[model samples]
Target: MAMTASTAGRRYSNATYRAMRRLKTVGLYAGVAAVLAYMLFPYYWAIVSSTKTGQALYQFTLLPALDFSNYWQLFNNPVFMGALVNSGVVALVSTAISLVIGILGAYALGRLHFPPGRMVLIAVLMISVFPQVVVLSGMFEVIGWLGLYNRPSGLIVSYLILTLPFTTWILTSFIRDLPKELEEAALVDGCSRLRILTHVLLPLMGPAIASTGLLSFILAWNEFLFALTFILTDENRTVPVAIGLLTGSSRYEYPFGQIMAASVTVTLPLLALVLVFQRKIVAGLTSGAVKG
Candidate 1:
């Protein structure tokens, strides 16, 4: 009788342990789902609101009304179209320029031995942390002096202040973590430093480049203060500034639907880019996290 009772008690304890573990797993998944919903709800709402028009827009429903008149109106707006082009030009050009410069800087800082290397990197980091508002006056004076004010070139130059530091820092860290054997082998093969960087390191740095470039593009694309302050003409404005200037039929009315539509339009491309490069971004971010 005692032996049977002990066996039964042990079985009960095992069963309870399994149940508790399952419950814990379920709770963890539920918490993750809740967090996802919280983060994604705003994007979902923007998309739904973009599809709504007239009285349907004001209705508090989770589902879209299936209307697309807002998008039609958005595309028909010439100013928005022009702004879109300007934003693309600024973002792509700035990202490309920053990457080129950052790669060179990263190579020098990461690969070469220099006395003031750490100091230079620290200065770059300090520059990066500076608030846009603080540098606005200085950047404005420089832009005017360079004859780039009221031009896309001004926006691009201003964006370098934001993008270049980030790219340089990230690329520097990534390159520092790379094996020296690759560059040594290239050098053994009669490759010059520039050739080794271009041929050997460049190919291996794709993930880092993609990650930094995407971030730089996003920063430039969504920049507002510089775009607004620099570009005087409506035709030269970027998406963020142009969207802010969007007006409704009457002075008292707000074009909520059109604004949402524009928001969705600008956001979709970024979403697509993220999804496409999701693997690369993850790989780039996690490359040096663990070692054999």
Candidate 2:
């Protein structure tokens, strides 16, 4: 009887311990979820706020209304439309140019054991991080001297500083992580460097390309400082500067509805891209660290 009682007690203690451990795990996950919700609430609030009519906006409405008034105002406003076009042009051109250059450069660095390879990469990183303000004067002088001031090309040139280096470094890391045997076999078959790069290497770099291109698009799309500093004309101003500088132009403070509408409008393309490429993004981001 004594042994039976002890055995039963042991079983009960073990069950209690397991239950407490499970509760602890659940509590931990719940805490993490709460933190994530706190972080995301502002963005959620913005989505809700953007849909609210000007009167309802400040009235503490929690739910986003199913309406098109804000969308209509955003589109019908010429300044918003102009800013949208300028932002699109700048983002598309910069992303395309940076992709071309970054892909070629990344491939070369990945394949070649050239002298000063590490040094070159370090230099590129330094150039990418050098402040937009530091280059402001030189950029202004060059653009003005060449008569490209207030032109899209001038803004494009300025944006390269924002996009190119990060794109190259990221893609270089990705290319380095790809399998080496394919390149070796192609080289052994007497394929030239260009042919091998075009056929064997690039074909396998779909994830890297998608991630890098998407990132480039985001960077160029969101850049404000260089856009503001480089382009001064109404027709040429990128969305950020247009939205940001509006406060100075209006006496009663810029319209919150207009600003909110513009903010959401500019954010839609990027937001959509993020949603569409969500899976690709995760794979691209993790494959380098995991597979490498």
Candidate 3:
């Protein structure tokens, strides 16, 4: 009788333990869900507000009314279109230039043993952290000297200051983690350093390049201060600056719906890029961090 009682008690205890574990798992998932909702709520609201119009925009509701007139109106705006084109051109050009320079610089930093290499890396990191406002006056002077003020090219040049440091740092860390043997073998096969970089490292570093390039593009695309300061003409302004200057038909009213529509329009491309290259981004970031 005692043996049977003990067996029953063990079964009850096992069931209780499982119930506790199940509750813990449920609680963990709930916590994660709550955090995700909190972070995503603002973006969701922006999307919802973009679809509302007139009196409907004033009402607070979770559901969208499916009115896309605001988007049509935004699309028809010449200033917004010009800004969008300028943003694309500046971002693409800046990213390309930065990537080329970053790849070569990172390779030299990672693979070549030279004096004060660590100091150079540290300096690059310091440059990344320097406030943009501190350099604004100096940059404006330089832009004027170069005759690039009020041009998309000027924004491209200014964006380099933002994109180059992080790109070089990330790429340096990534390249440092690559197998040295491959590079040595390329050298043994009578391949030049430039050849090795173009053929050997370039193919192998696609994920890291993709991650870095996307980040650089995003930074340039979202840059406002430099664009605002340098671009005197509406045609040369980027999306962020253009969005900031968005005004209603009347001076008294704020165009919240139009603003939200423009926000969503600019945000979607970034979202698509992130979603498409998410795995590569995660792999590149983790590999650089862990190995270095």
Candidate 4:
């Protein structure tokens, strides 16, 4: 009788432990699902709202009416279309320039040795810590002095202040992880530093470049203050500023539907880019963590 009771107690304890483990696992998954829903609900709401029009837009329904009139209207507006084009031009130009400069700077800082190299790297990182508004006055003055004010060139230049530091920092970390043997081999083959970077490092740096360039592009594309301040003309405005200036039939009335549609339109391409390059981004970010 005593032996049977002991055996029953042991079985009950084992079953209780399993039950607790299963309960904990269930709680963890439920928490993750809730967090994801919380984060994603706003985007889902915006997508649904973008498809709504007229009186239906005011109705807080989960189901979208699937009306695309707002999108059609936005595209038809010359100012909005012009803003889109301007945003693309500025973002692409800034990203390209930043990448080129950043690659050269990263190579020098990461691979080459100099007395002030580390100081320069720290300074570059510090530049990004300042708020855009903090440097707004100085940047505006510089833009005006350079005769680039109200030009796409001005926006591109201003964006360098944002993009360059980020690209340099990320690329430096990535470059440091690359093997030194490859560069030495190239040097043995009579390859110049530029040649080595262009031929050997460039191919290996694809993931880092993609990550940095895409982020730079996203930064420029979404920039508002500089775009608004520098570009006086409606035709030269970028998407964010232009979208802000969007009005309904009356000045007091806000065009929620059109605004939501514009937001969705601008956001989709970025989402696609992030999704496609997510692996590269993760790889680039985590590259230098391990020595071997």
Highest lDDT among the candidates is held by which one?
Answer: 1
How high is the CA lDDT of each candidate model?
Answer: 0.94, 0.83, 0.92, 0.93
Give me the candidate number with maximum TM-score.
Answer: 1
As a TM-score, model 3 comes out at 0.95
Clash count for each candidate, listed in order shown: 0, 0, 0, 0
Off by over 4 Å in 3: 288-292
User: Using TM-score as the measure, what is the rank order of every candidate, best first?
Assistant: 1, 4, 3, 2
lDDT-superior candidate, 2 or 3: 3
Misplaced by over 4 Å in model 4 are none
Candidate 3 local lDDT, residue 89: 88
Model 4 lowest lDDT segment of ten? 283-292
Q: Write the per-residue lDDT of candidate 4 for residues 1-292, one digit (tens) a residue.
A: 9999999999999999999999999999999999999999998999999998778877898788888999999999999999999999999999999999999999999999999999999999999888999999999999999999999999999999999999999999889889999999999999999999999999999889988899899998999999989999988899999899999988777799999999999998799989999999887777777774
> Candidate 1 at residue 191, lDDT?
97
lDDT of 1: 0.94
**lDDT for model 4, on a 0 to 1 scale?**
0.93
Name the TM-score of candidate 2.
0.90
- RMSD values, in order shown: 1.1, 2.3, 1.7, 1.3
Tens digits of per-residue lDDT for model 3 on 1-292? 9999999999999999999999999999999999999999999999999999888888999889899999999999999998898898899999999999999999999999999998999999999999999889999999999999998888888889999998999999889889999999999999999999999988989899989999999999999899999988787789999999999889988899999999999998899999999998888777745543
Lowest lDDT 10-mer window, candidate 2? Answer: 246-255
Model 1 deviation from the true structure expressed as Cα RMSD, one decimal place: 1.1
